[model samples]
Target: MTTVVGIDPSLTAAGVSTIKHPRIAGNPNKPICATMGRQGSNADTITQTAIRIGDQTRRIWGSLPSSVQLVVIESPGRPNPNAPGRFAERATVYYRIVEQLALRRIPVVTVASKTVKKWATGSGDASKAEMVAAMRELWPAALIRNDNEADALALATMGAMQLGWLEPELPCHISPNVSWPKGVVRV
Candidate 1:
């Protein structure tokens, strides 16, 4: 089976999740949820963002499964004046990941922030804690470590639903909720 990757891209903690084979010889072969990320304070300088972008990109790239066919990433957040460089940092990681995957012809789909929230928790403005809680309720098997992972899990589950490998069972339409690639559809 192919892998569906979900990413909540960020320079600080880039949440990456994959719905692949199974966990620990999963006899029934039911796919499992796996998540990973590195959380740290935002960079303070241009040089810092530059350095961390490479590191974040590497981590994301390493986390991807061998047969990644679809990637669902949350749209980049608007720039925050307080952070100053937040927009550049985020947009860079988003572009690099897409660019890398594009080279291999992997289709990447982006979902709006509010759409991710609403689809996952029935509210477009759900809080980070709320997202985590809702995801845990949906897939308790996953060790949801943070909000980023929760968002990424939601995004991945959405992609999995698109491919029919997994179903979130939520009361939401995948195609209507997210902008699908050319001809992909839920099975």
Candidate 2:
């Protein structure tokens, strides 16, 4: 079984999910084999944020199974001019997490926020509640507690569809523009 991981990286509460599936032309039956996330102390000051990033990065990487085939992470939201500090910290953490995966030679891809929404709810402008509802409607067995988890799960499923690890189960958009890096073997 090939493992696929999905992550919604937030310093406060990152949502992570894993699924193991055979890369064949068929539907995945309740494929949510595992779920885990790293919760860190609040990152307030620059030093605290740096420390949190390091700790969370290591924990996130460790959370993955060794047989992982692909990782799909939800990209950070746009920088809010008012909350510039928070945005910067989040962006930094996001890149550091991605870098850690690259160092380990793992194939990682980041899906845009709207892309995830569109894939899950068939609307780029879908609300967070809408996403949660859609996920509930689609994958009833998944323990999706919040929007973060729902988004991450959607991203993983979309990535699997994109990489040909599973059949497309949703009538939504997986952007044709996503460029998988060199190590990723596209089917």
Candidate 3:
């Protein structure tokens, strides 16, 4: 039973989803539980956000079962063309999470925003509403509210698909030989 935790890191409101292998036969990728965490608005500084995200990640990671084998985080896609440095803030937060995960010796993986979106909704440019709709279709009882949580859940689902954690509707083969260190896997 492998456990995978996915994160959509942000300075203001980091989103997270934890999934476990299904206990019943014929179903392997069902998530047993899920959660989300938001940094307090009082944490006005980027440094404070990083610290908060790190602390929250540590706490959540600690509470998981010893069987947890992988942690997947969503990497910021191409920086906003119009905003220029808009992604710098999120990148810093992602870096901090990666650093902390490495220190803990847990295997970490990263999936691009486009890749996760495409995998979830069949369109890399899918809107937040579309993503949320797709997630609801996948997990009818999932109680996801905001887009951040939906994105986090999508990242987790993509990670599970990549790791062959999910039983696909169509017969498919995922290569386990591909090497992924503590960072992003370019799809």
- Candidate order, lDDT descending: 1, 2, 3
Alpha-carbon runs more than 4 Å astray in model 2: 23-28, 31-43, 173-177, 182-186
Model 3 segments beyond 4 Å from truth?
24-67, 81-86, 170-187
Task: For each candidate, give its TM-score against the true structure.
Answer: 0.86, 0.83, 0.71
- For residues 1-187, write the lDDT of model 1, one tens digit per residue: 3778899988777788877634332554333444444554653476766777889888888888878878999888788888666787788989999999889889999998899899888889999999999988877767888888889988888887887776557675344377789856866
* Between candidates 1 and 2, the lDDT winner: 1
Model 3 clashing-pair count: 0
Error of 2 at 67 (Å): 1.2
Best by lDDT: 1
Per-residue accuracy of model 3 over 1-187 as CA lDDT, tens digit each: 4667778776566667767655532343445334545546543576765566667656555545666567778886668877554476677667767787778687887877776677677777989898888877776666777677788777666566666656534221233223366453433
lDDT of 3: 0.65
What's the lDDT for residue 74 in model 2? 81
Position 163, candidate 1: lDDT: 75
Candidate 3 clashing pairs? none
Candidate number with the higher lDDT (2 or 3): 2
